[model samples]
Target: MTQAAMPQVLIVDDDRAMRASLVALLEAAGWRVEAVSRASRVAETLVTFAADVILSDVRMPGMSGLDLLATLQEAFNPPVVLISAHGDIPMAVKAIQDGAYSFVEKPCEPRRLLTILRHAADQHRMRRDTASLRRRLTQISGLDRMLLGQTPGIADLREQVLDVADSDAAVLLVGETGTGKERVARALHDLGRNPAGPFLALNCATLQPAVFEAEFFGVEGGQVGKLLAAEGGTLFLDEIGACPLPVQSKLLRVIEDKQVTPLGATRPVPLSFRVVSATNEDPDAAQSDGRLRPDFLFRVNTFVLALPTLRQRRADLALLMTHFLEEFASVYETVVPELTQDDMAALLAHDWPGNVRELRNVAERRILSARRGGGSVAAAMHKDHELDDVPDTLREAVAAFERELIGKAIRAHAGRMDAVAEALGIGRRTLNEKIVKLGLDKGALL
Candidate 1:
């Protein structure tokens, strides 16, 4: 089997001869190897190496293999194979109980060692993939907590996203510039089966055609292309309307056959990944204008999500503005500034051809307009721009008001929740409920 995407192995042994021998053997077998001297140094080396499986001798001078396994138990430890010169039935059983992958005795057969090590690497890949997928899912789930607003367009888009997130079919995201096509792609990926798999994206409009093939199919210089790197995951082609006609043919082949031949390689590399393409302009117009090929269009048009423009979701503007304010405030480390009515009207009146991205740029400018050194920047902020803090989603609006009320209550009652609830004239149950719902566990006062 080709070792292009094989798991990495780390070998640890105090013996210099043994370390050199193991390194040569693994390298000959088309495996990546990192050799370290002692058990204690494994953790520090792993910080940089990130081994899929560890092979170490049990009877080390300072720290034993069992000790190393115990130390790494709480962390995301890779599968470990412990080798020993004095290994017995009792020692082997003890090693297994201590989480060793296999306990091989000294003078181990090369074939047996290879078999056990490869199996250990396989287990490590599965565990690591699962953990990575879980993390991606959690991150996407948090981003969708409010999803900015409850407009019909937004609601429909969310439903559409869920309906098609699980499929491996090609997805064409059509939208106005800055309508968050990439965000939709990521949501689909996070919800897909291979959430932990690689996500490789290329901007078709930006790539130089002369260099596109080498970049896409990779060169002898070890510059792996998106197709190979994103195996078992998703490959996103951004600005698909600008894709070159020559590249278009090969892209279709890969999409249809799930395989790619590198620039300098003879044989084709097998690839299995979901294709998600996006274009800011109308795909039909592109095809008619000869910018996009008809067959290419048909192949990639398995599913399409037409993202709504900012104008179509004007009802979500106030809440979107609030989300941006909170987000930018956290980013720029500034006090959340106020927006006067004029600012609101200015924002609403504009056609916003550039969509939500344009509004985000305006929000950033609003935050930057306020005086940075002082605390009373909010009062000075609204004088220039007529913009005010307006929460977009129901969750966000409720959270904003809840934060203000609880903050005021805390200040009035000297940070005592019981006293604050009584002073606010609300029951303790209601106050606690609001606190928990608004994510106020570690509030400014408490």
Candidate 2:
């Protein structure tokens, strides 16, 4: 079947008759119409209906149409043409600055209004399309993939990523566990010039303390260490603060001399890789504790990228949710689940200690579980054992249960960190830290 090409316009007015008349006129002009008499309900209506233009009366009871226009400007950019019975040119000009697309006097010139609506719709379509393209480009740039956030803190981090990616400066990514330090490291490698070169990653914490030196400096059998393996590429050392004191000295030598001497071998292997290290611990504290050498810290700290906790970027929940939904849908071969405003509200309300990684897990689980007839993501989320019963007197137990519930939700959402964060009423970054602290395996969510 051929889809209709009519553009949709939402008419908001206090008068039912006026709204009906305007709808009729617009429909006659080969446009699709949705009319809402109450300004208070326009926000909810817009959430469900896709519209090209909005025709709103400037004055209305309860909440003025102007107020609605202001709210819509932040959520979505739709061309809004204000209609005023008592038209004031100055007020209209002010409304334009406040984001109204245009203003028209009421008392009905059907032809003129249609012409204006068409023009406004065209302009809105162009702007929306452009914004969509920019979002796609941002995603393609792998900026969105670094971590989910639209806050100023996140914006600053993104700028740092771009700046540091342009050079070969060694970077130290500082953040709490589960804050996606490794993801940021990968983003740097992907955005850098030698992306095609080997992108090697190793978690310093995963290596046994006894074998730290042998593992990092390579062993005798001619086995190359992670640093040497990433020659002409990127070497990402996660939990760098976890490296043993003795190994720290060896790493410092490699960074200063640009070479690595394998254990039980005299000759040093030339290092030609860009190093990006991550740590959940404070660099200065680690140095004072003798867990990290100050010289090594200075060498790797040529650039520093500190990831913000999820709570700091709550405004980005919707954007991150949308991005993760699309990602999980492709992975599971299912259509993306539609999220209601309440769902989004719940997500924005919670404090996520887990960060972006936790959000991804939750989204993936929700998609898969919902597809299998489990129920809504929010409902399925509550079924986890951790959220099932509350135990009194054990604050630590309660905290642990909360973490478990958050983790289960992430798993059920299929690794969509934003969706899981929303379902659990927590911030994505907060949830990330909790996941790390609780040692939740995101692989379960996938």
Candidate 3:
């Protein structure tokens, strides 16, 4: 099994010797194990370990396992198993009632302990997977199609957006280019208190310094500003970091005073709308470099949501690729072509500097190219643009280079396995194994 597929356990106990013994026992049983002397550290360790089952002693220095159970109840935590020599019927009953998966007294049989842990871990994983499936179903059923992906980062972002959507606070979205900050901002508006109200968007970088206030505040009687236009709704400001200093001051005043004075009007107009701002640049850096005013940044950034880049969530690539491929194929009135293993390998190998937007474009290009009877998806991906030199890992870089070299060799040899193997100085069987391992489409090459 892969490292991610391995069952994981976290042991929390005050006794160092007991922790060591449990770690050894679990590791011997083909389970990944981590142990901590304090129950309090379990939460901190869990941030990275993601244990399927928490095997903790009943008593510890700072916090008892019972107390830990109480805290874990607040979040989506793994099943916890409490163990202690002092365990009794009353304590066991209390632990079970408090959401402990199972209770074991001191000197648990090796086989029994393993069996219980296995069951608990399996159940925890099943429940988590079920919840994730339900969440995806909800997304596809109209929660918001734009904020897609089942990766932990995206899932956490979805939860955060839902949590703050109804509130009328100003939110600042932070992410790299093409990470879909605008989509997130739109989701916030659509799910907010005034979905029926107008959702106005503005790009600060597109507005000249002289026209910024006029566009935001509007002329006296000529036209209404975006703030007024977005009454009872949301005003999304993209590239807020690029807002001019003068306009930032005025914007801050409007946000603070809850009103704005028209460019040629003396009277101030009352405004009621949430501000959802997005910036591809760093706010701190922008402020330091004088591109953004500190007061304006503080005013607009009531809450901040940071979006993850594509490389950070590669696990969701298959789902995202499928979604885009089918979507574009349907739009273009073409059959959904099956992506060969080589296509998948190429998709995974990309650095995706343009994030999800780049993936969507590539998928569309694949459908369009196939409509005109063009080459493979892998070939189409690199037809226009050179491969990004920076790979996320050495392994990925080497694998990608190997895939390219072998693909060229197969084309040169006309897909004759023996000829290709001879040209590459490897046995035919070994070459075939590499073809399968690297996910090359030999038939497509021919």
Candidate 4:
């Protein structure tokens, strides 16, 4: 362990000689020690040296050791041992009641004092470790479970989320399609300041220009707007860039003012809720194209959290695949199929344009197919390829068409790469590489 990791004790005594003696004794006893001549100075000393245990003289000038113990109890949880010549049975009992870990009489035996300090330090270390473990457990079962991955991008993203989750700031989630933007949005809400409060989600893309205002702001009827309904909680607006231009301006006003007015009402209702908005479009391009309002974008993007693409975090692919397989296997009550080397190679080579959502769907399909008696992960992946959105450009169209042909040929040839290659008029090596590149797994071909 480093020097900082060593057991540390802060000694507070008004007697100059006693302070020096105690410091020397503790240092000799294999403990890092800092001695202060006053109880008031203990707090300042603690700023630099975080003592695991505080050993202080009960009688001090300004703040008594008891007073320091009281203050430290509220600020931090380090164990405090109080010692004084005036220590009586009643005073010791009262000190313990006031949260001192232990009380010792002065003219104390060095061996016994060291023993008490050792116990105090150990107790403090245990308490700190337990608190840290509890926090890790909370993250594992809650937020980390939802956003599962070991990639640096994902780890950084989790750190960022935890940092801002407790604040009342508006957050913007930027990502590509199927990158779990909504999951991230929900995480921001559930892990936020008001987990128990309402979490209202609205898709701006589905909103029509005519009814968008009335629906969002609420009419003169009994219906309350999302802003009002999400009081003390969160309102997640997905596809925020797709919101009509005029409504975006009004949304910005509501956010900035922390109030909102219904379409038919004259009075503005006080609004209070964290706005967590998401968009797949590039903010700069959207703003330049006039699809997203600049002022509205800036207002919502107080903390812009850019999510990593599936391609960017390919290292987490196997972990995510296993997670999805286990989840879907339990749902379908089937044995999880083990992926062959070829199948894994195919998975690694494929350009996962659809991201995690696509991977999850493939896993579900594989599980369902397994329950039906016989199917391959490769086949499920082939299905995913076919189900991909229509290609927009000539290059993509050609690639998609070529991938489909190769998939059909492999299935027809019964997993024989040689026959498939011969049938396609391509070399065996070319066929193998293409199969891997296309994510058409060997099991599916077989």
Displacement of the residue 70 alpha carbon in candidate 2, Å: 30
Residue 274 of model 2 has an lDDT of: 90
Where is model 3 poorest over a 10-residue stretch in terms of lDDT? Answer: 129-138
Per-candidate RMSD, Å: 24.8, 15.2, 17.0, 21.2
Q: Name the weakest run of 10 consecutive residues (lDDT summed) in model 1.
A: 371-380
Instruction: Give me candidate 1's TM-score against the actual structure.
Output: 0.52
Residue 33, candidate 3: Cα error in Å is: 30
Relative to the true structure, candidate 2 reaches a TM of 0.57
Global lDDT of model 1: 0.79
Cα-lDDT of candidate 2: 0.77
- For model 4, residues 1-446, the per-residue Cα lDDT tens digits are 57866899988999998898899998998999888888888767878888899998988888899889888866356789999999899999999999998999979999999999987787677556434443443456677788987789999999999999988888999999999999998898888878999998888877676766677678776676656788888988899978888778777887888887787899888888899999998888999998998889888888999999989998777667767877888887778766554556667888888999989988898887666445666788888656458788988888787787777777777877788788777899888787777777777556
Evaluate model 4: give its TM-score: 0.56
lDDT of each model, Cα atoms only? 0.79, 0.77, 0.84, 0.82
- Residue 285 of candidate 1: its Cα lDDT? 98
Using TM-score, rank the candidates from best to worst.
2, 3, 4, 1
Best of the two (1, 3) by lDDT: 3
For 1-446, candidate 3 gives per-residue lDDT tens digits of 89989999999999988888899999999999988888889879999999999999998777999999999995458999999999999999999999999999989998999999998887777556545544564559444466778789998999999999989999999999989998899899988988998898988877776876687788898877767888888988899987777777777888888888888899999998899999998999999998898888988899999999999999877677667877888898887666654676798898998998888888888887676444576876784486456468999889887787688778877777788778666898998888899999988877
Q: Please say which candidate is ahead in TM-score: 1 or 3.
A: 3
Candidates' TM-scores?
A: 0.52, 0.57, 0.56, 0.56
lDDT of 4 at 229: 80
